[model samples]
Target: MRDLLGDQVLDLLLERSKDGKGGLRLTGEGSMLGELVKSVLERALEAELSSHLGYGKHDPAGHGTGNSRNGKIGKTVQTGVGPVRLAVPRDRAGTFEPVLVPKRAGRISGGLDDMIISLYAHGMSVRDIQHHLRQIYEVELSHEAISNITDAVLEEVRAWQARPLEAIYPVVFLDAIVVKVRDNHSVQAKPAYLAVGIDTDGEKHVLGIWLAKTPLDHATAGESSRFWSAVMTDLKNRGVRDILIACTDGLAGFEDAIHHAFPHTTVQTCVVHLIRNALRPVARRDRAAVAAELKKIYTAPSAEAAFDALADFTASDWGAKYPQAGRVFEAAWDRFTPFFAFSPAVRKLLYTTNGIESLNYQLRKVTKARGHFPGDDAVVKLLWLAIINIEDKRARERAAHKEKTGKIKNSPSTARLIEGQRTIGWREALIELDIAYPGRIR
Candidate 1:
């Protein structure tokens, strides 16, 4: 029955409702879908967050030093689903600390308000959801109640902006999507920058989030260089030493910053961005052939081969109509060539930004109904809650993969030194120990 209602519904329930003899019941208000979710989720969030603060497992989203001392308090992140919280077993204790599995911000993790707002962003009208709640769970949901949900994320968003991060990542991908915001004066929709990273193991993690200037003109206060610099500094302090690769759509001076911070890393402009950027300059009649030719270049056996293919395809097909397309490829030709050195396995991973793209895709799915986030904290609250979903997905995948392979890797062994550490008088472990290391035994 839990799986039947799905994660989204279950998450809402975990946040706002409590388990009862009669099935799902609201924890606070009259039982109904929206109100119930708002209540139960908020209640569970408070409980979980209280545990974190008491035991010091982590800080709430809005607080910051860019770093902090972690404790052993394990708690669940009650989602709309049931309590989707992680109780880090006490036995494992301090030995196994998870960075990404736990949401980094405290305030974001403090409540369920943003989770409700994200639902609104995802396309559920406030009244529609209110009506749905009344009909299903029989709870009343007011517009202001919904606003309260979104308003919760603002503090978290602010802290997330200043939170410290690891110094090096194997690969980092940067991109953005539009989100609405209300500043001191007026309310307007703005672009929200999304930065995501892939660790050596391939699990994707969120670095932080930022809001862009609205009005659709790329030149506004939305994409500030200072914010990007602070993010870089935080990563450095967190012990990130080498960034092997960076994937981005296209940001002015972002490349320069990457080079200044980590000179050894390779930067690859997203092919999706390149193709989209190049197409704007091509003729409609010739766009199909041009697109096909560009695809061939990226798909070629080697970067040299890709260049050759680009020249030939352009000459016969697009010709003078799309000369700039060829030049665009030329400018980015060096980092693009690494694919030629990769086997099919490595190439598939390097060529696309699918790992990072998934984050934005999830954001769109999660926030479809919300026209604007009340402030930054609202964004962090919803996103921090969503991180739990990502961790759960990763855990399931890792468990399934381990089960399929029958054996685990990287186990430690004491057999090699056991004999040396013991002295045997008879046919005992000490005898083997003596035989293994004759002079070393006492």
Candidate 2:
């Protein structure tokens, strides 16, 4: 590469790098490095045009050749150091294509697009990215240009959303996080539903994300059955034949939605959500006492025993004071008792929607800064970038752990939307799940 620049250009570059104060400036605006890059690229393009025309410039043996240098076109390209202006040699035949710097391309440097995507993934807005590039790289980019770079990933997001899934998921957690989006000339909160499925191997995968078309009602704060049914049908269409246990936060009609798509699946209402709702009406001082009593019902030896515990709690003073607490458990008793049928190890995984909630927590961190998204596509774009960022970070962590320990760690205390890490005690839970549902594990 340096040989292509030749000695004269190299010496000029070095001479230009020195400042009047005896310092060297190799980066930022008007840097010698940018100038060197510009010079090399222009030289390379000229060489390519010469090779295409089958002769050297101004040394043609025949003057009647069909194609010749018509003139030069002025172009500016983005580089890591900064933007560089260049004069690309043109040909009369219009068939000379430059490989070093392709026509109609604004960026010539590799990894610049990926860097912009990484910033967008980490929650930097388009304006933020524009300012960052100008301030740090001394390169100016318009908001539309930055958006165009990030928008390139929308196709990848579509492909990922429509990708095929495993025939069976041992456990799938369903949940949604509300994001404010512009709708009907106003900003409204809309739920972006997500499903995180634990494959037969116990590794987690985010099945897909669906943005609600209409805003959710803040008064009811309930998820729509129609929206979830479409999401579930999308999963079914994508090749999820069965889900052994589906855990949810008791969203409205969530049970029916799951059952409508996968009739045999067991829907387990999230026990933690239940506990939180039951304690909503309790005073702060009495919440601890009330929670201990509520724990007895979920921790009992069997479903019958758990019912007995619930009855006993209803008769106790704390339950008498907070009757609505016991009623909250009774309201969702059918969905809540499915986990009790399994052993403690399996019940631990089935009893809560913590896995999906943790994923929502990470997504919220990415979207929290935005006052409202311009549209559903914008919301999906940002969230999809955030998911890619998360999976990439996890991949690096796993690779580092494997390098240091010579083996990968699989035991995470809670189920996470990580591809390689397995849920702790999943082997034992799988054994129980396999026995509980014959032929479904496959």
Candidate 3:
């Protein structure tokens, strides 16, 4: 329903229902708002019939047609406020299908659908949603009814997964989270891969999601490479011709797969992930100092400086005791030092898989509620719904920020100014990319 129409109807109801004792009064059973909604819906149904018949009521165009309106049929539909009795138009040919509310739909209000979807997205289970409806709206819906409503988004998820992507993404962050799904009647942990991309304009977008074919113990080089190869192949198939930088955790074989998929793409290991991994072998008493020393490498002015710091760290007491930590850094040195080549702004984006990691955090909240999904599709559906809600919240935040700062979200040049920063490394980073990659930016 149009917001303006609903607001106008609400205003009319409130103004006419004033107690006339200079105070507001409650609009009960035959309330104007309820009646107005019923009237509008009935009129819309009539309009649908008219269009299907190719003429207005009693018009000459429908005179000889066998699809002319027969008479009105009584159908009591449930609305947000209460049950509304509507006289639906019917035709002789029975070809008129109401687009506003399908014939099989008992509840006709858009408000109810929004409420159900919002509740589901907020982590309410099916039973919890049903309870909310019953307790608040006094409407008892069957399990089938609620399932049908939520399952309607399956096709949406499918289409979103298959949608074409941008030709070029300056940066893409890849990561995964484990979700339990039923496999051959037994539940098992499976990885769901997420790719988040930064468009040419600096806005963030989720590229797509992929579920690994097998239940891998960890994101090993062989396993991660195979999974990422499939993901990159799909992205390329969907129009992603080039990706400049890919930020990822130290998943073995990931960098090689990236090079093979998008030959020129630079793969940066998430410095945060490296820090976390390095801290694992350090003694708790020495963790703080070890973390402090590790920070010097990532935050160093250049790769040479970072290497120098690493060399110094290896000779330190903590490094000698927790030699594994140094070895871990050494193992991923190539991927870890790529961020030092770029400006701080670009480094801020490329130095971590935190983009997709944050997304995984949100997905975890929803998936955690379900002990195990019935199947992979169920896992995808819940995560997809959660992603939609997350994106919506982010959009609202962006809009509010724009209202407060009067700066557009997509404006790369003014973004730093809006963010109250001296430089937005992204623009300069793009220039460096153009010079480095040659013809890849456009």
Candidate 4:
């Protein structure tokens, strides 16, 4: 490459790259690296134009070919290191199309869009991104340009949201997290509902994400029957014909909503939610004892045994003192006891919605940095990007762990609902599910 540029040009580049203090400047504004990149791209565009015209410059192969070089067009493009200006070659016929830096493209390919999206996914606001690029890459981008770049993924998000789903998901978890969005000229909290499904192959997948239009006004406002029904209907329309078990965080009317879409899907209230709700009213100091007492009901060997344990707890001192705690379990007992019908392995998988909760936790970390979003689209866009970022990060961690340990870690915490990563203990769980719901496994 240095030989191709000749010794004089290479020496000039090296000399230009040297800082006044005797160090080298490889990046940032006015760096020789940017100039070198500019030269390489301009040369590549010229080559492409030559290929398009079927001749080299001033070759004189045919003087009367009726097509010739016109002049160079100046264009500026954003790059990872910085922005570079290029002299794009044009033709007399206006037929040349340069593939290296296509006409009207403000940013070059090769991961600039991806980098911006990744940064946005990790919770960097548009202004933050602008500052980061200006400070680190010495590239100045307008707010509108940065927004347009990130907004390009809205189409992808729509396509993904409308994509067909599996016919049969052995288990599906429904949950929602609240996010602040601008509405009615003020910021209001809204629910972002997510559906995660586990297919018959034991692989996990996030079915879709929906941002409810109704702003949350109270604790239960985010979990509504109408919104959840729409979500369930969406899954059904997208090809989810059967779900053997639907786990939820004990949202009001959630059971009826699931039944409305998939009547055969057994609604199992999330044990963790039940426990948390039960412990919420208990004194913090007594929570440990209350939780310990509550565990006996869930861990009981059978539904009848669980009921007996519940009765015993209600008669105990902790249950009498915190009667609401016992009522929390009693209210959810119908949905809660479904897990007792399955084997212990299956029960472990069906009893909780931890996978979706973990995903929500990650999404919150991304959204928490921003006090509020401008609109629903902005919220959806950021959350979608964050989900992609999270799954990618998890995938990298899994790959790294496998490389170092020569074994994949099948831990519950790593059991994400995307990328087809199998949930821990799913194989054993599936066998029990097959027995529990004979024809549903298919």
Candidate 5:
């Protein structure tokens, strides 16, 4: 090669390539660089083995040692430059473990696994990923191979779910979104419940997700209650010692579950859901009018005044025309009005499950592309990916904003956004809570 280069063969080769075959190709399997990489890797492995044995290959020092060099084991290792055949060094003692490429590793490089996870997290289907690999890298990965790669995240998901949580979340929004999953040999829609907690600093955090399943011999309603109970128990077990208030969409038996799990926690029904339920039985034309009246009740100065507004509405023309709408409001009046006891700032946070609903929207965007997941773990896996992606984006945006603004001199950190929200009327609410249920806050 040096003789040819000295004879100006390098210039001729470059000219021929520029004429037709395109520019230089420096890497990939079977290329000159690929052979060099393989040679270098094998040499490194031999060096590692030499270090482990305290002697070089064919060294006289190895003669008396209990452990000595054994014959090379030639193995085909999958690498970024495609598959390369490597002569892995072995020792008679069999105690040497290669750190560069472990014995069980089929792939010599980590790049492929990282790429597979990135594509899967972005909502690409297994088939789409197979085609992507073929087009981009001339690599054909089987459906089973892609599935195995994504399934590796299950252990991570379990560990994340079981990780410890904050001792106190001032507010938590609980809600469920439906995703289609294959169950009992058929695809069917099932509810996946999630909890989003707002720490005292006010930033939103996803607490966890649970797939709703009715245990055998238990009714749907009973199992639903138990499922929530289990969720609450999981939170407690994970170090969530106190939740000041829980905002929910008012799923039946859920309030009781909250009370059962955390005796002193306040349960506030989402006013948005309450309004939608209130409008369901009303005439289409009366919706605007009734919604206005309902808003008066929820936005009232106090619970007593809110009940007064409800009474006045029931006696009014619109409420009289849609009695069932008023009846629905009357049914869960206490849960519906818990926000009234809170200050306006707290009321804004607790009056709805919009925070968790927004997260569900993001989750749905990722899952909506698939008709149905093969299993529950698949659904959980995708949702976890979506959350990670969304959080990553928000973190980047926050960082950029902080850099541009320089400490937010006139404003606040995203933390302040949460603190300002949950802290408004917080002092009064805490005082009331502590007085009402002594030792709960402590």
Candidate 6:
């Protein structure tokens, strides 16, 4: 390539790419070194550009403004990163609003800050992520700075959680992931439930987040129905008139909770959860083989075929040792079969808790580092915020739909979207939850 293209050509390429940081120069031994040097310079500049932080009168970042003749601070631009640059406004009136250019007091891009928020969602401790930022980007990020970035999600979470929802969700997937939270002034881990609804329009939206002090303490004990009941009440208040199908991980009373709340909802067990539970009972060495065989059950061409595989599984060598695992299958057999009711596209989406559990995995990554939250409010705040930011990536998973008319995609449409209240008649089928979870409907 060097032989074909002269070093002068490489030098010209280097000059074009450089943005005033040291331009690349050809070294004594190397050919076209200047271009490589320019590339490094441009990348560093791009990195700083991406990390630019934002500012405003209500900036939560706590970057206090300074006094100037026109009572204006330097202006800066926001990039994909989390930080904002303080571009010096040309007009002393501080009226200039630069869109994508350099400004005074230029700071690094906010992307690292954005990453910090994501790491927080993944359950990284601010202290740890701060240290992480230091190690990764060599930036001295403060706890408050990191917290402030993540806290921005709270406003978004609040808006989403309180936003009016669709009247009916044709299919809803329910699942919970436990994360440690500071509860009751003690740092303790809690189970936070994540619910996702596939609307009649085939749009998947996360309904809300619910937290439980402990998995054992969730709803089964007479004291509280856990966060599920509260979530149900919230849905009702928000006008969730009907829920057609509910998929879950067979969490204790989760099905019952849905049954009681929606009354007519068809509660299905997550096929994936059933598989995981079934495999747990198999021997470590033989588990993979057992799982392979078990896969035939759910993955079979039809429910009949799946049941045939199930029967075969029961007759297999591992059945005795992993009997309880098979029972998990037996218990969920009715719920698991619902997937067979839908077309392949819908069936694949509904049979598993993939929609909600993926969100939960994101939730766990954010909350995992914290041993526990301060209290129920703190738990609620963090989880709600985490869900919003996490779900913001929803479009990546979604197909192109007609854009809606709302500043926020999750916000309610001007025209109401309530659906028919066709009950799945689960109340007569499942146990009735007499517990009343009281809360103001948003």
lDDT of 5 by residue, 1-442 (tens): 6683464755554443342357554444444445655777898999999999999988999988899988888776666655567889899999989988779766654767777887888878898888877765545567997798888888989998898988987778888888888776667788888888877555567788888764445333222677778788999999998887888887767777778878878888888888898899888877887898888888899999999999999999988798888888898888887777666866776778876787787777777778888887888888887777776665566677779977533222342221123444556556665665567555
- Which scores greater on TM-score, model 1 or model 5? 5
What lDDT score belongs to each candidate, Candidate 1 first? Answer: 0.57, 0.84, 0.76, 0.84, 0.75, 0.58
Pairs with backbone N, CA or C atoms under 3 Å apart (clashes), candidate 3: 221-252
lDDT of 1: 0.57
- In terms of lDDT, model 2 sits at 0.84
User: On a 0 to 100 scale, what is the lDDT of residue 167 in model 6?
Assistant: 89
Candidate 3, poorest ten consecutive residues by summed lDDT: 413-422
How well is each residue in 1-442 modelled by candidate 6, as lDDT tens digits?
6776688876676665454466542331122343343344344443443333233333455334342223324433322322233323233334444443444423334554566667766566767886765554345666666666767767766777788998876667776676555544455545666677766545567677666544443422121455567678899998898786777777675666667887777787888878887777567898787788777888877889878888887887777667777788787788788667544555566667765665566666766667666555566667765655544545422222324333323322221121221223323211221111112111
Order the candidate numbers by TM-score, best to worst. Answer: 4, 2, 5, 3, 6, 1
User: Candidate 4 lDDT, tens digit per residue, 38-143?
Assistant: 8788888878878887888888874788988999988888998788877888999998877778778888866677788889999999999999999888788889
| Runs of candidate 6 exceeding 4 Å displacement | 1-124, 128-153, 213-226, 299-309, 343-345, 379-442
Report how far residue 173 has shifted in candidate 3, in Å: 0.8
In each prediction, how many residue pairs overlap at the backbone (N, C-alpha, C within less than 3 A)? Answer: 54, 0, 1, 0, 0, 46
Error of 1 at 398 (Å): 9.5
Alpha-carbon error at 238 in model 2, in Å? 1.3
**lDDT, candidate 1, 247-336, per-residue tens:** 776566667777777776667778776787778898788788789878888888877788898788668647566778887777777656
Q: What is the TM-score of each predicted model, taking all chains together? A: 0.56, 0.89, 0.75, 0.90, 0.76, 0.57
Off by over 4 Å in 5: 1-43, 49-98, 102-105, 166-168, 199-204, 216-223, 240-242, 280-289, 315-317, 320-324, 403-405, 408-438
Worst 10 residues of 2 by lDDT: 213-222
Off by over 4 Å in 2: 1-15, 18-26, 57-63, 92-99, 215-222, 404-416
Query: What RMSD does each model have against the real structure?
Result: 17.9, 3.3, 6.0, 3.0, 5.6, 12.8
Location of the lowest summed lDDT over 10 successive residues in candidate 4: 214-223
